[model samples]
Target: MIGSSHAVGTDAGKSVENTFTLDYQVSGVSQGTITNDSAYTGGAGDPSPVIDPAGPTNFTVDRMIDLAVTADNSGLVVPSNAQDRILQYTITNLGNDHQAYSFSIADVAGDDFDATGLEITYSRAATDLNGDGDTLDACEAEIVDAPLTATVPGTAAGSASYTCDIPADLPFTVELSGDIPDTLADSNIDNLVLVAETRNPNAWAVEAVAPSVGGVTANDADGTNTITGLAENVFADGTGTSEEADKDGRMSAQSSFVVTSPDLVAEKRVWVLRTESDGTACAGEAVPAVEPTTEYPTPGACVLYTIEVTNTAENAGSDAENIDVSDILPENVAFVSATTSGFNIPGTLTFKKADNTTNCDGTAGETCTVALTGAGLAAEVGTTDATAQLYIRAIVR
Candidate 1:
């Protein structure tokens, strides 16, 4: 009549047995010992008298559904106004049996902004085909179906066959993809949570689905009268920090998105674009790199100035927009023509009067201006560097 809870390390469906023995003494004198089953030969008394069954007491262990989730990247760097930004997580089946899981991403309260179009995806085959260090490509990790099934780890080497796809006790990688809102300044943060619920591997149903919802009730129809001979399911999922309840067959992990902004830095230098012998400026000889620092430019000489604007910001959400670069001409110099190079977007180069109110033709007492609209300067993203150069050719008065 002794019982104990199942041990944790015991294999699912394994047998657990217990037997009892009774020792009697007559008038303070030791008699003989009788066992509960006939299989015990060492007992001196008639084994049939106490034999409860032909064999020892035994019952198969029931399956325990448990899981754990961890965000692969603690801080996911996301660009604002970007679509399908990926947040990766790993879900491990901690229980003794194979299980499928349904995933969801929820916005955490007290955060900066919420993500839009939240979707979950994973890839058992062809993960990260584009070699971009992530499975965000269209052809990679194509499985978007809910309740992603897991295979029991098998002895096979490849996933081409049925048994090879078995992932017993192995972890599955899942992606939570969403779109970031626009106009989010740098360092703004959005806390997000990814939840995973356990499901019946073969039935494609939630393991903890309530009976009122037309799902199987826990411990089967017999309830507490569980027949020790048969296997049953016992929900053992842990409560998570992100509002997950214990033994409810669900778990969750948290991740975040910090909005990043573009940091633009502009550097400008001037040189006298002229052949030293004469006052006439030459294109090949007097480039912007060869600035006239030691010797000042002669009168009527062209003072070539080059302004280089570089988007130094890394992981910027969007490109620098509505950009305007201007330089006021000194009274001792006359405004000349302006041009641009190394610019991905088209811009207008104009000269303005000293008052900065009206546009003026390249003439004396004017200011040089460059106006860029509609996708101005590109942000420094990934391997590409963003730099735009403006060339101004003004004459010494």
Candidate 2:
């Protein structure tokens, strides 16, 4: 069982030999000494069976290098336009012997958006020096920033992008910091994968600054040319959920960031006004009067609908921009007029029919698009309020 419990002393592809020595008497007296040697067969003074050679057997020990990366917890929830969001992870060495690892992170495809200014860092256990239960005070630990190199997976011949000195069967905490893009919607997710590759143990010390062709280029393990008495490296890392390939001296794991932004809700309410046969408007309730199943609007009745877009202060730091909303009139209803309010300053709201005209010409089944351009809406935070209302007047055919 050559595993972490009983690790192999010799390196992989190295030979291990054993021999035996015997000293026995034939009947009553001593028969001298006879040491087993596969190359010797009863030469001058050497006494043996002479027919076969005895033990001096040897075998080669193979190397197994593996590692694993896992997310520390669930996905991190971040705010829009946030910076330096921290994502934590753990890297464990699953090999029989101590290993040096190089780390890098990448944005995974098929996600909502890519995080900006990605950086790799080291995280230590939080300490409460102020006698508090949490490490929120200034006495707590800070993240150790690791400088990134332009070339990933491979650095200088004797260098790496980010290296960690990890012993066998041990786990190290790593962190990734990134900035969230501006104006991202709530519930949007961006996944990032962290990759750790096994580097040459020899290069762990005295890293030079010279470009190299590939990582682990010096004294690398050769599966085909495995010679005895010389240990070599062999990749045994398994494929991971983050699309990390097997036996490539690399392992990966993924974590995500979910955006938590202010909720922007739009609601529409409608009312009715009685009219004459000549389409002349008559007296009616100023507010929404007709309720479903209670009272229905008659032919040529004036219907007034109001659509309100409210930027609720559900989550903090969530301001919106480039707002556009469209409402299509149903059958048997002719479009009359439309207007907007609550949009001023740099922000301007405009309403247009499907044909991009200000007037809809009393046409049924027409779509009216209300757009707020220039400066977009801001959430009702502090003293600022961002709300827009669209009013439409339509008539039943």
Candidate 3:
């Protein structure tokens, strides 16, 4: 059977405060009841999840791979007087991400660039390094302005390339070019630097060789003679400096000097002053002779005469006298090479009286004889001349 239960509660109301009371109890044991609380509150707080923007991607450049130059890379051997040469450069991208690079050259010491005629050129190409199916138009090229620019279609990860050409003058500076972009990370993108040397083939040369000097004759008038030659080297080494063309091409320190004795004559002797080079003497093909006139007399004519002989000779003399004639010989004639006509022997001779008489004295009926005889006669005759003339000679041992 079902049983019922009941209970009661009270609520109070007062003058100062009002209150209500009510109570109720379950009539039978039954299932628990469910209640709904609608007016409940909680604390305030931040939201659960948030979204963040992506960061900038950094580009990495591997080595400036497969760098190359199209010029005579073996090295430019230019003449010192030649103009500049043209050079080309090629650089490939061996990096993973797309990258940019720049190029520049150095104006080295003893070199010049940026002249009016100097110039350069550039180009680019993009190709896959591996045999991949990806086709990327990552090739860009431009003239090397102050800021060089080149774009590769695909990322620089595989096969990106660049090329440049440079022309120079005056052996001054070498041209450099490459694909390096101006970016926030790197402001200067110079990829390569090189130098070309110059040479001078004709820098040194011989300018002149002196002409030969003529021979001189020895005479009593002039004592010393001189022979000379002049040579010079006027070429330069393109640098305004003198350089030696050959090791032994210089002029010798000493000049040349010479003296020669003259040829034989009737009562006169001759001497010569020959020219020389490097101490070697040179004789004239023909001996020079003095022309005789009334002023210069012959030997043994009893005429007024003067003798002139070069100082180089010690034994120079002449004889100008008539044998058989009583006339004293001219003073100009000294005993050089002499001979007698009336004497028994032919030799050097002196004039004397037959009987030691002074003033051309001799026997009363003997013609006042004066003649040469004996060894003294031969010695005197060898130095005496019949023609009233002077003789001269020079000897150098």
Candidate 4:
């Protein structure tokens, strides 16, 4: 109850960076020939013609699963002590087959802005109506919806703090394993869709029909979305845009929130000059100074006021600017003169602005007695001045 011909099939799980080999043999009674001329006593003719072709041949499987990531902050200014600072990131799957990733984005220290109360969540981009591009074309805004499955736990229900694997004690200088971008390219369909637009498989391209045929959702992020679950699909020959996952062609997405704010401190006192015999307490310091108090000087004494303004170290690659400060002098004092430290305004006060150069005006009794105006009052880090400290001294009569 059997046949002469037979077929065998084998299932090799997922695609990987490896090759395989297969070998087999078949034997049966010989039906070809029996050459016995009988010139000799003859031999024991066992007519089982056995044939086994060259084997151990190599076989290559191209079922691949790769991931990639991209981080975008949209250049949003997140002030210090700010809340709900949302950062949008897109994770793309560049592999021809479906994939899964343990997504992550950790807050690194040393930027002067601690990633305090750092949290993470995910969302799929909205549909693009332009029909030219993916998410961005439609709703590039932070339209965060529930992930295929939530990995940040309670975050899906409400804004919740993220669980960081990196310990707080870790030194800032140490580049830990849990860095900003730690995975492969994924669901940002634009990469492949654009490439598939031309439909020319790159020099490394090695498939038939592209997985990009899925278009925007070509790589539907499945599972918890804390990871990727890619849908495996082969690309077309010479037109394939499929990438190799194990060969640094994986995918990923990452983004971070930044907090920035300016801190301004003002100190008012009368600069009382002290000679050698003035007092032992003032002898040690050369500069004229006054004791800090609610009301230090009589109406006749010259009142020296200092305004010190600075800002928290803004996020890296960020600029702190457009900061202005104003003060109201005491009713007993009259504005006399004001000057800035060389640390900030080393050169003469130009009062230069956009296509105009002007001077500040206001007497001591005026409500705007001493106020920093124009662009001169900026906490510039990588700008015209190297010093972040802007010193302003105003003496009132």
RMSD in order of candidates: 21.1, 21.1, 50.9, 25.7
Highest lDDT scorer? 2
lDDT of each: 0.59, 0.60, 0.23, 0.31
What ranking emerges by TM-score with the best candidate at the front? 2, 1, 4, 3
- Candidate 4 residue runs with Cα over 4 Å from true position: 1-61, 74-76, 100-102, 109-113, 125-144, 147-258, 262-397
Ranked by lDDT, the better of candidates 1 and 3 is 1
Q: In candidate 4, what are the lDDT values of residues 189-219, reduced to their tens digit?
A: 1111101111111111222333332122222
Give the alpha carbon lDDT tens digit for every residue of 299-389 in model 2: 8777777887766443445566766766777656776666666654346555566777674566566665555456456676543336877
CA error at residue 86 for candidate 2, angstroms:
1.5
Clash count (model 3, backbone only): 53
TM-score against truth, every candidate: 0.47, 0.47, 0.18, 0.25
Model 3 stretches with alpha carbons more than 4 Å out: 1-74, 80-84, 110-116, 126-397
Model 3 residue 295 lDDT score:
26
Taking the tens digit of each residue's C-alpha lDDT, what string does model 3 give over 121-180?
A: 343332231225442422212322323322221112111122222111101112332221
> What total of clashing residue pairs does each candidate reach?
7, 1, 53, 50
Query: Better model by lDDT, 1 or 2?
Result: 2
- Summing lDDT over every window of 10 consecutive residues in candidate 1, give the lowest-scoring window: 157-166
Residue 84's lDDT in candidate 3 = 30
Write down the RMSD of candidate 3 (Cα, Å).
50.9
